[model samples]
Target: MHRSRKADAPRADRVGRAGSGALALLAIAATLAGCQRGSSETPTVPTTGPGGCPAVRAAAQAAVAQAERTDTAWDGPTTGPAAVSGRTVVFVAETMTNPGVAGVANGLREAARVVGWDLRVIDGAGSPAGIQAAMSEAVTLRPSGIVIGGFDPGSTAQQVADAAAAGIPLVGWHAVVAPGPSSRPPLFTNVTTRVEDVAGISAQWIIAHSGGRAGVVVFTDASVPFARTKSDLITAKLATCAGVRLLAYENIPIPDASSRTPREIASLLARFPDTWTHSVAINDLYFADAAPAFRAAGRKGTGPPFNIGAGDGDPSAFQRINSGQYQAATVPEPLTQQGWQIVDEFNRAFSHRPASGYVAPTHVSTAANSAGATTWDPPGYREAYRRIWGR
Candidate 1:
């Protein structure tokens, strides 16, 4: 059985946070515009810094080389509780429209079928009130377990507390900052690749692709702590390569990305037309939203401003990469695999076993290696989980 509802209007407070981030970016653009008025020459990217970029670029290339490998054996847990039969679970999603959240939901749905568990999904529609309401309803259902499917558990503290009081085991898919059991929010386990690994490789991709000299813009949703942290790490990593100039840090919220991205892209183009050589965003969807504006600006699909998403490689992102659209590469989470892990974690909780401390290794996908596939579904995980569950 499945149930879902549309979220109401966003909470005023979250909207304000999103707005402040956007306003800061606009102010940055305005200031840059004033500074560049007399200069017709493109700013030169510094190639020879204190140590020069050759060593850094070489190291980055090697790290990227390892991450791009598609043949990695499954490193997740090989032992776990066998399937607990006839259980019921609820998945409270941030929004079905978010590819990462939806992709994980699809995976969980598949895993639940394999495990013979009843499953329900409630869409939070990308708003605080909606997410809170969805969490409240999820707790009210008294399901055997609840999956916090991509929103911060802290935001729904009262409902989370209620579920905890009821002794419902909770699992999370990117619900917290870390990947293992979270004591603070009482999640059995949180499934995700390490954000530092994801962020580092993404910046390294740009460094390797550009041969160490490029001007870059980073896009992030400040409204989500996970996203903001990833983008901040990306910024810090990019700083290591002195040749890579940080042009702008655009803070467009994920929910408002489609409506605001085109306009922001236009502003970025006008502000740093010649120097902006690359982009990295916290999510792949930003590139999807920026495509039209790039087209209008006469930027080629094969771009000087090569784009890479730091996380969540959805079908659309793969299509863009394979077709040489706006995106060049992505550091994608293994969404389906993580979904299967979520079910596995819940099973462990149900069996009174300890949470599996497995974290998926970060991966980077590019046009050269993607081979036209959609999601970054790693091999052996499905078989491994099935083996563990004795299915």
Candidate 2:
């Protein structure tokens, strides 16, 4: 197990896709199973976008409906495996070095114990090769199921097939698409937020805040396919803004993100100067140094060029948002909540029950809510998963 980062201490710890249509509704219906849907009462959503982007405002308003699902309660398979008391569940973490990964593993460890399941977590070191090796080792154990955090589908196709062939149910957290119950994907299911939508949340905010005329400099991490998708969506959404301009769209693969982010921003600052209004990246980790770099370039303007990111919920990110400086909002996934949910997903698949994989309850933390929120876990969520298992 990797050492967990202290949320109150310092910063750093790095760490999605699409397909949310009819299958999405079915998945939501499955998770919310018996809960009643449909309500004309709409919740008031905050708008960080300027007054020009009605579309952005509408997107924010639409998020209110998801809140009705209320992911705090455990709504997984009620009759799963009678008791997963002796089942050895393998949790394949992308890397414990990252806070989000460590936090998720911690949640699963706690949840597994609560559910009386034997959990063996073979964590990675934040690399593609590391994930592949973990998957390879997991296959030999032939555990009841496997939960992959931050998985890349295209790369892990073979490993997933082998696990499925050997009768090991696989569930991914925030790395692949939910291929639906009928699609029969290599992985049984995926529990995640639509990363593209999460990133778009920030874009929507930017366009509104920018008065619908925004120039965005997008720095995409190409190392992960999910990150690529997020950046692609941000670019595409920004294009829809009435007076949008894409100043620059660069692929800063993880290998180069840390080393190149500041320079990339600095270069964009020099070249486009006033053309760029918002800066969106796959995650805030890439901007560990870029925030100061942005300030260093003396972008002392009014409120136009805001910095926003997804894969939100890191301590430093919240701090940046709270500071009301360069950061505007960071869209965060409820990682700890999803941690327990992943185990439940495996349980459902293991028992041959219809596994409607969950989409982690995600929300964007802006300056308005930074005081009330943190980046590690969802607010007001407790470990009540024991109830889901009828304990």
Best by lDDT: 1
Give the Cα error of residue 124 in candidate 2, in Å.
Answer: 2.7
| lDDT of candidate 1 at residue 118, scale 0 to 100 | 95
Q: Write the per-residue lDDT of candidate 2 for residues 1-391, one digit (tens) a residue.
A: 1111111211111111244432343333223222121111111221123445566545544653343233345443334443356788888877765656666777778777777888888876666677778888988898988877765544567887898788777776654543233233456777767655575566676665665767766665544545645565565566554466666566665555567777776777777777667777777766565776777887652234687766746667777777766777677666677777777776667667767544555566776654545554653334344555665
What does candidate 1's lDDT look like per residue over 1-391, in tens digits? 0012222222333223323443343343333322221102122333224543888799999999999999999998999889989899999998898888899999999999999999999999877899999999999999999999888887789999999999998998887666788777888888888777788899899999999988888887765666755665676677677677878778676767789899999989999999999999998999999999999999998897999999999999999999999999999988999899999999999999999889899899999998789999999999999999999
Q: Go through the candidates in order and give the C-alpha RMSD of each one to the true structure.
A: 7.0, 10.8
Flag regions of model 1 displaced more than 4 Å: 1-52
How many clashing pairs does model 1 include? 0
Model 2 / residue 4 / CA error / Å: 19
lDDT of 2: 0.60
What TM-score fits each model? 0.88, 0.76
